[model samples]
Target chain A: MTERSGTVVGPRPPTVIVDDLHVVYRVRGAGRTKEVKGGATAALARMISPRRLAGERRVHAVKGVGFVARRGETIGLIGSNGSGKSTLLRAIAGLLPAESGAVYSDGQPALLGVNAALMNDLSGERNVVLGCLAMGLSPREVRERYDEIVEFSGINDKGDFISLPMRAYSSGMAARLRFAIASAVNHDVLMIDEALATGDRAFRKRSEARIRELRAEAGTVFLVSHSLTSIRDTCARTLWLENGELVMDGPTDEVVRAYEDSAGRRSSAP
Target chain B: MSRDVIPRHGALDPEVGAAELAARYGLGVSGARPSPVEYTRRLWGRRHFIAAFARARGDGQYSRAHLGRLWQVMTPLLNAAVYYLIFGLLIGTRDGVPDFIPFLVTGVFVFAFTQSSVLSGVRAVSGNLGLVRALHFPRAVLPVALTLAQLRQMLVSMAVLVVIVLLAGQVPTWSWLLVVPVLLAQSVFNAGLALVAARLGSAVSDLAQLLPFVLRTWMYASGVMYSIGNLTADAPLPVRVLLDLNPAAVYIDLTRFALIDSFTAAQLPPYAWGVAVAWAFVLGVGGFGYFWQAEGRYGRD
Candidate 1:
C-alpha cells in the first residue's frame, strides 16, 4: 500500500476518471435447484428463444461509458429515461461500482436526488438537521447554520408544523427543505439528479442562485435533468446520453439546440 | 472559513491538469493522491458528521411510535417482563438459578442490544440506499449510528431494569462499578456486528427478511431466559461451543457475576470476555476497513 519511491504516494488522481463503466443487473429465480435448472435450460434455449430466455438475464444499464471531469466547469448529463444518466452519476459518486472502469474522484463527491429525502416520518425541522448531518456537516456547523437553512426554505411561517413529520408537508415544501439542507453545504464535487423538478418558482430561483454560489466556490457540479431550460440556465457544458451512450458533449446552448431540433424533426417526420 | 485557504483540487483547478500546480499550492493531493492512509484520514476527519447523524437517527427513530421516546424504556421492559413471566414464573425453569428476576431481566436487556443489532443492522445499508447515493461520508457511520441509536434505547431499558431490581429487594453492591466496563464491552461487540451486517445487508437485502427468524433461534440457543447450566451434558460439543461463541452468553454471565451469581467463578469462563472483546475488535476494525474500501461504491444502483 506504500510507494517504492517512499514519498508517501497518494490515491490516483481523481478528476472523475471513468473508463468503460458498465453496469449489468442479473435477474435470478428462487432456490438453487430451480435456479440451476433454469440456467441450464436458458443456456440451451438461447439460440431458439433468445428473448424469452429464463434465468440470469442481464440488463446492461450503462455500457462502456467513459469521461473525465476536471475542476470548475459544470457538466450537464441530459438523457431520456433509462438512458444511463443516473447510473453514470451513481457510478461516479461511488454509489455503484464500475463493472470494467474506474471512477477516480479527488475526494468524496456529494450526490443529490429526490430519493435522498430526510425521513418522511420526522418533522421538516428535524429533517433539516438530519439532512445536514447526512451531507457531512458537523454538529457545530449544523447548529450555526440551523436558522439559515430554515430561513432559506421559507417555511418558517409553517411554524410548529416544521416540527411535524415530513409526511405533513406538500411536495413543494419538502423539495424546498431538501434543497435548503443540501445547498447549505459546499462539497468538493456535487451531483444533482433532477432535484430541481419539484421546486416552486421562487424556490427554483433561490436554488439556482445557490448552485451558482457552489460553482463559484470552486466545486465541480453535475446536473442531470430532462428540463433543457434548467440545464441551459445552470450549466456551461452539457452531455447528451441515449440508450446508455454519450451521444453528445459540448456547450449547453449548442447541445440543447441540437437535441431539440433533432427531436422536433423526428416528430414532424412521423 | 471565509474563503477556503487551501487551493482547489478538483475540476476547479485553475491551472488544469498541472500536477505541480496542485502540489505547489498545497491542495491536499488533488485527484492523484495514491495513499489509502491519507484517504482514510480524510474520511475519518468527518467524525463530527458521524455523531451528528447518530443523534438525528436516534431522535428520528424514537419519534415514530405513539408513546414516542417512552418506548425506549418500555420496549426492553416489556421484553424482560414477558420473558420473566414465561421463563421465570410460568415454566418455573429457574429452579437452581439464584436471583431469577435480576438474572433474567439483565440477560433480556443485554441480549436485546445484540438482537436489535443483527436484526435492525441487517438492513441498515440497503434501507438507506437513497442517502447512500446522495451523500458522501463514511458508510460505516451508518451502521455505527444505528448501534448508537439502539444503545440509547437499550440504556433507557437498562435504567428501567435497575429500578425494577431495586423494587424487587435487590441491593446495589460495590461490584456494580464493574457493570460500566461490562456494558462498554457489550456495546463494542454490538458495534462490530453492526459493521459486518451493514456490508452483508447491502449485498443481500434478503438477510433483512431472514434476520428475525435467525435472531429467534439464536436467542434460545444463547440463553436469554434460562441459565446455560440447564442444558443437559448429553448436548453435543458443537452446541456447547456455539453457546460459548454467543457474545450474549458472556454478557449474561458477566452481568450475573456483577449482580447475583458470584459463587461459581469457575463455571463463568474467563475467556468469554476476551473472546467478546476480540470479536468486537476484529469485527469493528475489520468491518470498518472493509466498508471504507468500498466507500465510494455504496451509491451505485
Candidate 2:
C-alpha cells in the first residue's frame, strides 16, 4: 500500500466526494419470548437469533447517495425525520459505516451535533481547551486561540466558574461554550447537525456570521437541519433527502420552495 | 485549523478499492475512500493528538480536586497500606513469603494499574461517545491514551515501592532491571485487554460494571493477594493450567521474584518470562485487531 502524501486544501479542491454510499444499521434481537427450560433457553435463543442463523437484517439508512462538496461550498442538507439526512451527514463525516460506497475528503472533518456536550464536570472555560484538543488542534494553537474562543463564547465574567467545571453551567451556557470551541477554528470540512437550533436568537445570529466567515475562508460546511429558514439564509446549495435517497440537489431557493410547497400541501390536505 | 496537515492533492485514487482499505483499517465499511496507507499514516500523523489527549485526560481528573493531583499518589499509597495490613500483618503471610511487603506491594500496585487499564478500557471508547460521534480521528487513541496514563501512575507508584523495599532492608539486585521489560510486557498485555474490553463495553454497558468485579476476581486468581502456585499445587492439572493462563500471574510473580533477588534460580523457570512476553504480544496485537475490526461502528449509539 503506497502512502498518500498530505496536501493542503484550497478553493479548487473537492473537500468531500461521496459516491454510491449505502448505510445500514443492524441491531441484535433482545428479550427472547420463546419458552424453554432454564439452561436450554440461552442455547436455544442464541441458535435461533437471526444474527446467528442468517445474520442480522440491515435497516437501510442511506442508499445510493452521491454528492461532492468542493472548497468554498456551503451545502445544507434538509429533510424530515428518518429521511437519512443525519445518516448521510454521519457517513460523510466518517462516523457511520457504509455498506458499499466511498467518501473521500480533502482534509480532517469535524462533526458538530446538538448532543456534543462538553465535559460538564469541568468548568465552561476549561471545556474550551478540551474541545480544541479533541478537534485535533495542537497545544500551541490552543494557547494562541484560547482568548478568542472565550471572547466568542461571550461568557466572560463567569471566570473561575468557567475554570470550575462544566456541570455548574446551564445547558444553554454549555452549548454556547461548546459552539465557540468548535467554531473557533475554520475547518476544511465542518458538518453541523441542528446545533444551531437551541441557542437564543442573538447567539444564532452570531453563529451564522461565524459560519459565513468560515465559508469566506474557502472552507466547506455541511449543515443538517429541519429549519428551512436557517438553510435558506446560510447555504448556497440545498440537498433534499427522503427515505434514504436524494430527492433533489440544487440552489437553496429552488429546493426550499419545492419542499415548502410539498409540506404545505400535505398539511392542508389533512 | 492547521492548513499544513491538509493534503494538497487530487481526489482519492480510483484504481484502488478505498472501501476495502477503510474496512480493513476500521473506517466506515461503505463509502470509505481512505487510501491504502491511510490507516498507518493516520495513526503516525496523529501522534500529537494522542499525546494531547492523554495529557488532557491525565490532568482533567486532577484539575477539580481540592487535594489537586495528590490523590494520584495518595490513592495508591492507601491501597498498598491496606493490602499490607490485611495480607502482611493480619493474615501473617509475611512469614511464609520472602519480602512479604515488597512482593505484596508490587503485586498489589501493579495489579491495580492493570485493573485500572482494563476496567477503564472497556468503557474508554464508549465513555467518549460524544467525541467519537463528533470527531474524525483514530478510534484506538482513546484506549491507548488511557492505558498510557495508567502506566504513568504505575511508574510513580513503582518508585515509591522501591523506596519501601530498601527501607525494609531488602537488598536490590541486577534482576531489578528485569522488572522493566516484564512490566512493559504487562503494560502491553493490559493495553490489549483494554482495547478488547472497550469494544465489548459499548454494546453491553452492563459489561463495564461487571469488568471491575471480574478484575478483582482475577487479582486473587493471579496471586496478587495469595500464592497461586502454593494454593493450586494439589489441584488437578487442568485447573492448575487454568491458573497459569491467568496472564497477570506471570507478571506479578516475576516482579515479586525481582524484588527478593531470587527469581532466576529458585523460582519460575527462565522460559516462563518468554512465554509471558509471547502471550502479551499475541493478545496485544490480537486484541487490537479485534477492536479495530469494529472501528467505524463504535461511534453508533
lDDT of 1 by residue, B135-235 (tens): 65566777877887788777777778778777777778877677778878778778878877877788776888888888888788777787786664567
Fnat per candidate, as a fraction, reads: 0.36, 0.27
DockQ of each: 0.24, 0.21
Q: What number of backbone clashes does candidate 1 have, counting pairs of residues 3 or more apart or in separate chains?
A: 22
- Give the per-residue lDDT of model 2 (tens digit) for A1-270: 223334423324466767778876553444211112123323433454455325443456677886656678789998766677776877777776767877866566778887786566555656776677667677789899998888777666445446657777766766777788889877888888888887778888999999999998988898988888899899998888876788888889998999888878878995
List chain B TM-scores, each candidate: 0.83, 0.85
- Give the TM-score of each candidate: 0.83, 0.79
lDDT score, candidate 1, position B247: 74
TM-score of chain A of each: 0.82, 0.83
Model 1: residue A62 alpha-carbon error in angstroms: 3.3
